[model samples]
Target: MSEKKKGPYKQTGNIAVDMVAACINHYEKQGRKVAYIRLDFIHWTMFKGYVLEQIPAYDLSNGEIEFDDVIVTQGSSLQVKPLYHELVADGKPKVYLMN
Candidate 1:
């Protein structure tokens, strides 16, 4: 049996950011607005921290990814209402596939 080949989306030191970039690129190519992306607490915290480190003045509500300013509504917006309350109550990670 032959082993499967890995594309450029392979893991890296900053895999989180790389994945986010890829999602953004995909959406942009389709000319569709990215609604949001779900991420676990750890990854979410890391992403936020990374953004702050790079651009201290970045506004979270601007619907733009911190790394490259890719416009997308963060999943947090959706979770902020009853959804977040329910998810937190259940202790489930918020991670999700970016579309």
Candidate 2:
């Protein structure tokens, strides 16, 4: 019998960012068409500031920002923590791929 394969996950100081990066990588690898990434727990003001700093061409009117070929949307922290916890419970590594 074959045992289930365990993870060789990634890590970073910000687990949220790491999770996003991982998801992007996964989707990209699968050649999937990603609509957008919703980031929860961040305020609109902060999200706008972050976008301005990270993506100069981002326009808030559209409520979407593309970074490294991935479209992202502002979301709430409450929604994000549970996903992070799921990843952690699955033994995902803490790999940091975001600035």
**Candidate No. with top TM-score:** 1
RMSD per model, one decimal = 13.7, 14.3
Please give the lDDT score at residue 2 for candidate 1: 14
lDDT of 2: 0.51
User: How displaced is residue 29 in candidate 2, in Å?
Assistant: 2.4
Tens-place lDDT digits, model 2, residues 17-70 = 456557756755665644556666553345456557655765668876554455
The CA lDDT of each predicted structure is 0.48, 0.51
**What's the TM-score of every candidate structure?**
0.44, 0.43
In candidate 1 the C-alpha lDDT for residue 62 amounts to 52
- What TM-score, to 2 decimals, does candidate 1 have? 0.44
